[model samples]
Target chain A: MSLVEVTGLTKVFRRPVKDPGFRGALRHLVSPRYRDVTAVERVDLRIEPGEAVAYVGPNGAGKSTTVKLLTGIIVPTSGEVRVAGLSPHRDRIANARQVGVLFGQRSQLWWDLPVRESFTLLRDMYGVPDSLYRARMKRFDEVLDLGSILPVVARKLSLGQRMRADLAAALLHGPRIAYLDEPTIGLDIAVRDRVREFLRQLRDEGTTIMLTTHDLGDIEDVCERLVIIDRGRVIYDGSLAAVKDDFARERRIHLQLASPVPLASLSDRLPDAVVVAGDEPGEFTVTVDRFRQTAGAVISAVLPLAEVVELRIDEPAIEDVIRKVYAGELRLA
Target chain B: MMEYEADFWLLVLAGLLQQLVGLAFLGAVFAQVQALHGWTFTEAVLLYGFASFVFGMSPLFFDGLWRTAWLVNQGDLDYALVRPYPVMLQVSGSYVGLQGAGDVVVATCMIGWALSRADISWSPLTVLVGAVLLVSAVTIRVSVLAASCAISFWLQAPHSGFAFAINQLGTLGRYPLTIFGVALRGVLTVVIPFAFTAYFPVSWLLDPGRYWWAAIVTPLVAAYSLILGVRIYHRGVRRYESAGH
Candidate 1:
């Protein structure tokens, strides 16, 4: 059975509709008005054990809302969600033992407590054995370099340090399933890489992970499957390789000629590719469909026009495809 | 818990000074009149001391309830919800107020001094029952505060305005219930029951013949308040919508 199952889950928030300023506030106090805002529509999802699924969407696309629903932070307005065959909202304590959660925009650490103290408190709260707790802490320190920040208070730590500590707190109990929402957000590249590496290790250890992030690098490095949400609905769901293959077929090839070659001559030589002028007089860029033509094919065609000095192939990144989707430049169903 | 070591002591000292000033005010009132409504100066002090003691004790243990509104408004309750413990227990035990120490000390001294001066025959059984009744008073106080603070879930504000107002109402319990008109007396008895926190237990202690029933029912009132408080808090938690998108 799948570790996580969600069926037709929807949440509609009743927001108080208010008018402008002080007068409106007084009027609202006398007679309040409300409107229903559907945060999550009928959404269905399933994740098997040891699977790493990237849950991605633009802002306000209901990614956080869906995580909240699955984690039992909020009750669903309709449908059902089960983690480890137990209803998360109905059996919260049992579900809690099975799942670990981290929100990038928030910290679960006790604000006034030191990082080590926070971990110890969490250890007690989750009833993690001493042996396992020590082992996990050692592992976290080796990977995340948590030794220096462990003695520092949570509020005093920098954003990167805090994120690292929070990651430890969330995973201290060694839960079977982990839900990380934007864990790499607001983190520097070095810290982001460390977190990504930790997630990779976690996935390799047979932990089911549902990662919600906007960072395409995170998706490429850690997740095998991709799920894209838009406007409280899933627009696309499939494998990461499939998304790259289907939408990111276009590749760019850059070439520097030993002699200055006219753009028209290069266009004539490579009829199937789109030839464009490069930054310098002796440079030219060739856009090709990898399916229709290869970099070797395009390079050989251009070699005859001028003495080739250097050549570089730019494969399309999954980021470009996902960005296009976000910008409405490309549509996927 | 020791994170606020200096601030804790400072706040405790401030609380002690505040209670001393309140005791001084009670002294001034008694100086003007020998007795008000058949209760002596010592009896009034006992009632006031009981109220202050309970008020102080609540913050030392259950001070986290005061942060309920802020947590709900800021979406901080998300952490507690995902944890393996009861949300109410986590929230109520989140912080300890140092000022409670001062309240407890001053109130204890007042109760001790008043009992010594007052002409009341004491026995081992009566003392045990009195101890139980005092504990029940504190429970009633804490539970009522928790239930009032839980109203923040519905208000959706960042501060416990309703709880603060209810706490202000508790100040009235420091005096005899006879001082208030019939409407407020009814409110303190049936609506919120602040009277049970101070007046009833102390009255029963001072005059058992007329008010023995007050001492017997104090435990029941405490139980009812505790049940109501826990029920309201959990019900409010169920309605928690969590702020932010």
Candidate 2:
């Protein structure tokens, strides 16, 4: 059975309707009015054990709202969400014991307490055993280098250091499932890579993970399956490789010939590929569908016409496809 | 608070000064009249000390509940909700109010002095019952404050305006209930029930012949307020739509 199951989940927020200034505020005070905003609408999802699924979407796409619902932070207006065969909202404490959550925008560490004290408090709250607690802390120190920041107060840590300590705090209990929302946001390349590596190791250890991120590298490196949401709806859900193969099929090959050559000759010889002239006399770009023709075939066709001096092959990236989707240039629905 | 020792001491001094001022005002009132509304000066002081002591518990221990408005408005309660513990307990225990330490000390001294001066039959059962009633009074005071603070979940404001107004009403609990009109008396007795925090419990101790039922009613009021407080807080939690960061 799936560890997490959500069906027709919807959340509607009722906000008071007020105008921009003092007069409007006074008017609202006398006769209050409210408007209903639907943050999540009719969304359905399921995740099996030991699967790492990337939940990605544009801003205001309801990704955070979905996580809030699944973690029992907020109740849905309609529909059902079940984690480990129990309703997340109804059996919140039980569900919390089985799952770990991290929100990159916010720190779970107590603002006034040191990082180590926060972890100890959480250990008592979650009832983690002493042996497992020590083991987990040791493992976290190795990957996250938590020893340096453990004594530092939460409000005093740098963004990168706080993220590292928060990641450790979230997974300290060895939860069966981990829900991480934008866990690598605003981190340098080195820290981002470290976080991705830690997530990969966690997934390898048979922990179910649902990761929501705007960074495509996090998805490619740490997740096997991809789920894209737009306007509170899941528009695409499939394997990462399949999405790349289906939408990102075009590959570009840039070539600089030994001597000047006619662009027309290169285009005619390679009929299946589109050849464009570069600024230099010897430079040409060939765009081809990898499914129909290989880079080797394009190279061979170019070699016969002109001596190849230098060539560079560019594989299609999921980043481009997702960017186009966000820009409304490419439709996934 | 440990990081700012000077500020902590200044707040402690301020809290102690406020209680002393209230005591001086009570003394001035009694100088104008021998026994205002049939209650002696010593008995009135006991009532005042009882209310002050109960009020001090909030700042010293349950002061974190005062942050409910800020937490709900900022969506800071998100972490508490996801934790494997009661959200209310986490909020209540989040912070300690340093000023309460001073207020509790002054009120404890006042209670001791008043008991020594007041004429009452001493017995082991009476002392034990008085301790239980004092605890009940603290519970009632804390529970009412919690329920008031829960109003923030619906208000959406960063400050607990409604809760603050209700807390102001607790100041009247330090006086004898008979000094006020019936309508105000009903409000103090039933609406907010601050009267039980000091008046009723102290009344039973001072004059059991006429107020014997107050001891029974005090604990019942505490239980009712506790249940109501917990229920309102959880219900507010259900309506929580976490703010966007």
Candidate 3:
């Protein structure tokens, strides 16, 4: 059986409608209005043990709502969610014991308290054994470098330090599943790499990971499965390599020739690829499908045409593919 | 709380001064006449002390409930929800109001002095009953505050105006219920039930024959308040649609 299962899940929020100004406020006081916004609708998902899946979408695309539903932070309007055989909403405490959650935009640490206090509080709350708690803290210190920040207050820590502390807080109990929502949202590249590396290590330890992130590097580095959601619905669910092969196959090879060359000649040689002129007369770009032709083939084909001085390949980025999907340009059927 | 030592002490001082001013007012009123509405100055002080003591306990232990509106508005309660403990307990324990130390200290002194001065029979049974009633009063105060603050789940305001208004009603608990109109007395006794926190139990202790039912009613009201508070809070949590990601 899958560790996490969601069926026909839906969450509709009734937002109160208030008009502008004092007159509208006064009118609302008499009788308020509300509109139902369907944040998540009829979404079905299942995750087996030890699977690291990247859940990605644009802002307000129900990614966070789905995470909340799975973690039992908020109840659904309709449908079902089970985490480790327990109904997440109905048996929240039992479900909570099996899951770890971190919302990157928010800190779980007690604001005025030292980082160690928050960690100790979480350890007690989760009822972790003392020996195991000490061991985990040692391990976290090794990877997250949490020692320096332990005595510092939560509010005083820098963003990177805070994220590390929060990560430790979320995983102190050694939960079977960790739902990290944008865990690397606003970190510097160094910290982001460290977090991604930590996530990969966590995944290798057989923890089921449902990672929601906008950073494409997070997906490429840490996740094997990709789930792209848009407007409250899952548009694509497949292997990361498959999505790249099917939708993100376009690669551009840019070349700089020693001398100016005619575009028509190069266009004739590479019929399968699109040859576009670059800024200089000696420079041109070849856009090719990886399946039909390789970057090496394009480079060799161009080498014969002119003396190549400089060349670079623009690899197809998952960010571009996701942006197209978000813009409703790419249909991932 | 020790991080802001000055702020903590200033707040404590404010609470202590507020209570002292009220005591001075009570002394002045008593000096003008023997009693107001057949209750002596000592009895009034005891009633006032019970109300202050119950109110003080909230900031000491359950002060985090006061931030319900702010937490809900900012979606900060998300972390508490995912924890393995009870959400209500986590929320109520989130903050400790050191300022309540002053109120508790002053109220304790008032209650001790008033009990010594006021007329009452000394017995083991009376002592047990008074202790139970005192605990029940504190429970009633905390429970009512919890229920009112839970309204933030629906109101969506940053500050708990509704809860603050409800707390303001607790001020009426410091005075004699007989002096108020019947409708307001009904409100204090039944609707919001601030009277159970102070006036009802203290009145019963001072004159058991006239207010005999209050002994039983205070504990019952406490249970009801607790149940009501927990129910409202849990229901509100279910309706919490967390803010944007």
Chain A only: TM-score per candidate: 0.97, 0.98, 0.97
Order of quality (TM-score): 2, 1, 3
Model 3 DockQ vs. reference: 0.69
Docking class of 3: medium
**Residues B103-165, model 1: lDDT tens digits:** 999999999889899877788867997888889988888889889989998988898878999
**Over the stretch A153-198, how does candidate 2's per-residue lDDT look in tens digits?**
8999999999999999999889999999999999999889889989
Task: Give per-residue CA lDDT, model 3, range A1-333, as digits (tens).
Answer: 999889999999877788989988999889989898998989999999999999998899999999999999999889999888899878989988989999999999999999999999999999999999999999999899999999999999999999999999999999999999999988999999899989999999999999999899999999999998888998899999988889999998989999888999999989999999999988998999999998888878888878999989988988888889989899998
Off by over 4 Å in 2: B1-3
Candidate 3's C-alpha runs over 4 A off are: A17-32, A258-261, A299-309, B209-211
Off by over 4 Å in 1: A23-31, A260-271, A279-282
Instruction: Please report, as a residue range, the 10-residue window in candidate 1 chain A with the lowest summed lDDT.
Output: A299-308
State in Å the error of residue A38, model 3.
1.8
Candidate 2, backbone clash total: 0
Q: Model 1, A221: alpha-carbon shift in Å?
A: 0.9
